[model samples]
Target: MPLPTPPPTLLRDAALFLDFDGTLVPIADRPDAITIAPGLLPLLERLQAALAGRLTLVSGRAAADVRRWIAPLEVAVAGSHGLELGTKTAPRSAALEEGLRHLRGLQAEHAGVLLEEKPLGAALHYREAPGAEDACRAAVTRVALSTGMEVQPGKMVFEIKPADGDKGTAIQTLMQRPDHAGHRPVFIGDDLTDEHGFAVVRDLGGSGILVGEERDTAATHRLRDVAEVHRWLNDACEEMS
Candidate 1:
């Protein structure tokens, strides 16, 4: 059956988690190349307040990076695919170093690959080098097994993040906080990496709304794309008001 659209009352008692790329904004050729909508900041601020400060942006980028992109809007954010909480990242790991080295070598080999260095791990983006997908996947998966890091595959990038945490763990951790008490989790995401989050929200008696094309996803609801996402949020804000 096709997934249902979330009702207007979905945000009534929600602790909302939103994915960044391909959800809040369109995916760009380069991560830094994405441009935020002029009204997005205000809309997010309104939604955050309407939700009683239970809004968070869950992304694979560093928390600091997301903060830079949505500056002056103070909302909760989890980055590095939820491995990094807020601006504070975990200490670098030996396995992570090895993974970074491996990615650097791969970047050298595939000049078109862009290596994004993060505090917890690294990502090799092959959007500019679509032909290097197999190489990138193989390198990351190989390094992950040997070094015990996690290989996160996305639209056109392979990320080597710490194996310890994922979007599920981050949402779980956030739910445990006093502020999240009595609230149901509602995750809105648009990537394969977001599967973990969808599963967790379902387990928590909340809902998951997937963006983009339909697939065998854990999400129970669907939004067409970022524009629909904005409409949903706007409707949510209105209903919850």
Candidate 2:
């Protein structure tokens, strides 16, 4: 499919929020296979400078994972679906440790599923064994029922993350920062998890860009894939110069 061209208004935005997997890096078979291109950090750094520190990366992975892939970039990062938040300069808080510990402890009881401990939460991946879907769901459901954490279902993965910490709150928090205070927000993502974020940006008088072929999204715009998002981002950054 051809990439959708971004609207001219996108280039004039003040704040930019991006997703990591399937946005910055292409999706891979194993979540760990996704590689951050060598140039991605430099590209984002240039964009950050152009956007005046109004750029942030929000993802389900741990903030450390994001940082490892795109190291030494001073952009704000919200990891574990916003349960672990941090700026470039400040050390990340460990408030989610209890939740992480609880989720990690469930792995022994849940069979045929793998548990990944994230910065602020945990994820149970059942993609490799489709036959274990029910077990996976049951495991995650059991965990959610026991703990107050919300279950965020994604492509073959169920994450037990903080209910209150979402992309919307992350956006609001990022916007409140001094550099992003006056900027109009622009959020771009490609999952059901991103719907609330789209609504938040819309409510804030900004816009959301959905990256997929799905219809009826809360996003104001839709692009085809990660490459399209990158192309549009490059164009936006260039236009801002």
Candidate 3:
């Protein structure tokens, strides 16, 4: 069955929030090559001022990585999926020291695989080493189950992160701020990691827009691909300008 298209009013009334990879930037063969368009940063900058600073890029990448991708113009940036929270009002570190301590042991166990530790969480990426996927998941799951953390699955990685910090938590935190207090929230992304963020916006009387092929969408709307996301963004920027 075809899902109904969400109205433009959803974008109009909402505070626009987005995810980076697979949402704005196309997924790359190498994750490092997911670059934002040259004009995108400047367009987003204009939108921010038009929206009265209501734009945010909520991503799983580190804050520094997000900065590198979209430099010069600083929108609200939440990196490490909701782990490293940074906004004008509050700057939060990962608060995951204990989680990291445990992850190091697991990293040693899976030394050949990529174990990335970001400020908010730790991930065992198996994209490059598909042979180790099952073992990596099992190892990460063991840690999550024993340590009282939750596991988040991304494109080709398994993450064990704190139950507390998620995209929902990040959105709720943003909504509570004085500058954005009255605005509705709209989150957009594509990936299993984006579910928490979709839920956050829905619960806050906002909406979620999913990009790409649909599963059971917590998202209220959907777009075909990253290009569509860019088109919508361009439209929004024009409207705001």
Candidate 4:
């Protein structure tokens, strides 16, 4: 199916939501292995200025981590699948601690499986151990169920997070804020975890742009890859200017 073309002058009044890893930068085997593209920070600064600070990053990474990656430029961010909102940190719980321990043990047992700890959750990455998907999923799922955490599956990763909220709730919450309120929302992301954000934007009379390959998606438009995303964003910034 063909995606609809985005309006030429959408950025002036749009609330933009971006996903981090796969959408803004290419996914790496290890999360820390990824690097931000040159000139990307300046582009985002311009975009945020163009959008009147309504631009936000919604990602599975911690907000602090995202800030660290894009140092010297601060923007609103919802991290840990919306477990942490803005600068407010997600509270740690015994369940999350226990889940992390279990995940760490699982990572130790499986070669090439990497464990990423978050403020409110943990993730098991199997990018280097493609054959261990079943085992990783099973292990995460078991721990999540036992600890009453939510299980989120993404491209080559399985995450155990709090069941309290998701990307949809994150976008919705941002929409109600003074800065984002009354603006049209446009969310762009890749991965199943982003589907919730897409649905929320569509429900709010906004649109979603899917990055990367075609799949079952709620996004109305598509960009081929990170390069295309940067191009489209640059165009939007230009339009606003």
Candidate 5:
């Protein structure tokens, strides 16, 4: 009773969507501390070409942030939990300005809580302060309600984003492009925010590949970690070649 490998045949007509962070690179103590492997850019370039420009990186980080990390590649990217795609960045709610002040207050109380400011929203990472999870979630929930945003919970993090923006809408939007149209979707991600993309791929008659240990997920396939993802992409690229 182990997870089955995804059929290589699916790559034949796939419009690939990838998640950054825990999928492309390992999660870091600080958001900016991740180390991108030297070969990652080349691998993505190869895969993007093999897929005929249908590969897109959908990430929770802002578009500029993601681009800055993977510079010179120039591939399609959906950032800010899909709130920012290409050159478009979603606007933050007016309340977020005041919300940030409140979050700053919370950060002062907890020594290790990391507060990340994005174009559309903000996130509180409590990885360094495990005991602050409940307080962080509560504070973020309050901010979300006041800002007309939604609370998005991920691994040891809580975020507030525009209520309408999500990875599902991001993938669906990209699928309408001429190069992406008619191609089945195959999204790979790890975290609660990715469930939106997972559900969308299933609805589109494609699939989702989850990275990390198994849980109740919409993704049909499980890849143990980022290394497996690299291997899978290498195999897919070779198959296409």
Candidate 6:
């Protein structure tokens, strides 16, 4: 479905939380294959300034990885689906280590399965081998069960992390901080894992923007693709300026 027409006025007082992959940049077959847009850094910098540093990137990727990908333009990030919050590193867990080992073993067995290690978790990506999705899911599920970790499914990926953390918890924690307190939230994302974020923002009397095809979503609005997201964001910046 097409996105609703852009709003006339931007919410300068709102706190912004954006998902990186598929929302900020298009999803790549390989996690490392993604390319950031040429002017994204400047745009985010402007947006962050306008919002009083309330802009944050909330992604399933590691916070360190996110920072490296968007280097030289520092911004708050919640990585590992919120397991690693802000600049603080997640504490090492035996469950995570064991899960990683299990996933690595699966990666060796499956031709196209890739294991992405995180500070507190791991992800099994099977985008290159769609046919192996079932096997990958099963392998991750088995590991999650044995290691007492949570299984988070996203676009062609399965992540195993501690059961306590999620995007909602991350956003809520940020909202309580001095920089974000009392501000309305506006989260935009493009994956099922982001549903928790959407629900949290709405419950806080904010809004959620969904990107890509229509489905059962918690988002209040929709944008067709990454380009539309950029257009909407640019328009919002212009309006506020």
Task: For residues 92-120, write the lDDT of model 4, one tens digit per residue.
Answer: 77776777788888899889999998877
Clash-forming residue pairs, model 2 = none
**219, model 6: CA deviation in Å?**
0.7
TM-score of the candidate numbered 4? 0.96
Model 6 C-alpha lDDT per residue in residues 1-241, reported as the tens digit of each score? 5446436353567999999999999999999999999988888998988888899999999999999999999999888887678566656667667767778888998888899988877889999888889988998898889878888999999888889979988999999999789998999999999999999998998888999998888888888899888889988888778
How much is 54 displaced in model 1, in angstroms? 0.6
TM-score of each: 0.95, 0.86, 0.85, 0.96, 0.96, 0.95
Give the per-residue Cα lDDT of candidate 2 at 65. 83
* Full-model lDDT for every candidate: 0.89, 0.75, 0.77, 0.88, 0.90, 0.87
Model 3, span 1-241: residue lDDT tens: 6545556456565688889889888886456756677777777777787778888888888777788778777778888786677643232233355556666776676645667766555788777677778987886787677667778888888888778788778888888888778888999999988998999888888889888897897888888888887787777666555
Locate the minimum summed-lDDT window of 10 residues in model 6: 1-10
Among all windows of ten consecutive residues in candidate 2, which has the lowest summed lDDT? 87-96
Stretches of candidate 6 off by over 4 Å are: 1-10, 87-91
lDDT of 5 at 72: 88
- How displaced is residue 48 in candidate 2, in Å? 0.3
Score candidate 6 by lDDT: 0.87
RMSD of 5: 1.3
Among all windows of 10 consecutive residues in model 5, the one with the lowest summed lDDT is 85-94
Candidate 2 residue 59 Cα shift, in angstroms, is 0.8
Tens digit per residue, CA lDDT, model 1, 157-193: 8888777889999999999989897899999999999
C-alpha RMSD of candidate 4: 1.3
lDDT of 3 at 124: 82
How displaced is residue 39 in candidate 3, in Å? 2.3
What shift in Å separates residue 204 of candidate 4 from its native position after superposition?
0.5
Cα displacement (Å) at residue 28, model 6: 0.3
